[model samples]
Target: FMMKGVTPGPLLFQEQMPLIWILFGTFLIANVLLLPTVGLLTARIAGTALRLPFNLLLPIIAAACVTGAYAINNNPLDVGIMVLMGVVALMLRRGGFPLAQVVLGMVLGPILEQHFMVSAIKSNWDPLSFFERPIALILMGACVATVILGIIAHKRRLTGGDESS
Candidate 1:
């Protein structure tokens, strides 16, 4: 659904603008070609396969997740962490907590921290500089709005009001 051309490589290596554009084109082409197959597979899995009983499918899913974690680096620690996170996520779901927010925070927290640190360094450690940029202010506003809307929607759901926000 998206294309990622340049990754977080060293600045020196990423300075090759021509190569970066070429890589972007390649990634875009590959993603476009694969989109139909990916869509079909997702539709098939969501429509039929995912409707199986949890008791029958959970073990298989757990095994697959554990295997994937281990396959990442052939490390038991990865598997342990995966299982721990799985348990925590299950508990959160049972408690009526939205898992998407948790996942988004987990994935984006470090990236945001790194960017903030870099910006502060570039600004000679001036914290106020973060609010000086128009883009940054707009992004901050968007973040605040998203959180507020999410809270309102959650409260509405809890109060048995309209859920299709």
Candidate 2:
């Protein structure tokens, strides 16, 4: 994305708002289209997936991961940290804890905290001022919708996996 001049951050959200909307729109469209694609290809995908030798696949995946991590800024230390984090993640999984929420918190928590601090400073610490703008309502709607969809998807995955409604 940086090669395409599309770096992601709060600044990206502010400066590239239209791109964000476009991404959200495309993702919604893709989700709609994916259902039919999955329905048609599930059997073939399942057969292929079941035939995959996970024991051999693990080392290949690790190599690909290390290569990919190293490709980012060509940093060996970053690659090592990624491997360490992968080991930690594996341990967490073995402990029967859900990784998704943890991963989301790790990624989003700081950003959300930054936003909150900025918002408070800008509003003179006035919470109600956040909703004064017309755009705020739209943003709130989008956020609520996203949370609702995430919760629904999480529940469905937890309960039913691939055969979910």
Candidate 3:
């Protein structure tokens, strides 16, 4: 309907909005089907305390990783890069750097830089103008407040139980 530019009539009420509802229904159905199976498997694993020998597990994991790398393009070189990236992530973590953040930054950095450049050009390089928009300012403020609150909550959790006196 959106693509065709056809608006739903008043009688239909939410025909235009049903796509979102359908997506949510599908998500709920997937979660409902998977969650119980996952929980049962987790319980069974816990009870069995089943452990694969490192020798067996390592090859299985490596095979699966290589398969995934190959699946992307059928290129052995990609597997080499994937292994190198995994090793780099491990080394970075060992060095006290946040590996997840590094990966996220790397993944998003190009897209972010592109958008930043486009927005700056569109706004005539007035960076402050980006925050002048009401929605942008509100979103920025919300993000900052959330980070601050998270920090305070985390610090409190780290400090342990307070005196009840």
Task: Assess every candidate by TM-score.
Answer: 0.59, 0.47, 0.55
- lDDT ranking, high to low: 2, 1, 3
Residue-level lDDT tens digits of model 2 in 113-139: 999999999999998999999999899
Q: What is the lDDT of residue 165 in candidate 3?
A: 18
User: All candidates' lDDT scores?
Assistant: 0.87, 0.89, 0.84
- Give the per-residue lDDT digits (tens) of candidate 1, residues 1-165: 115444556662556677767778999998998888997788988788778999988998878888999999999999999979989999999999999999999999999999888988999998888899899899999999999999998899898897575
Instruction: Tell me how many residue pairs clash in candidate 1.
Output: 0
Using lDDT as the measure, name the better of candidate 1 and candidate 2: 2
**The candidate that achieves the highest TM-score relative to the unseen native structure:** 1
lDDT of 1 at 50: 79
**Candidate 2 least-lDDT 10 residues:** 156-165
TM-score of 2: 0.47
* Deviation from native of the Cα of residue 69 in model 1, angstroms: 0.5
As for lDDT, the candidate ahead, 2 or 3, is 2
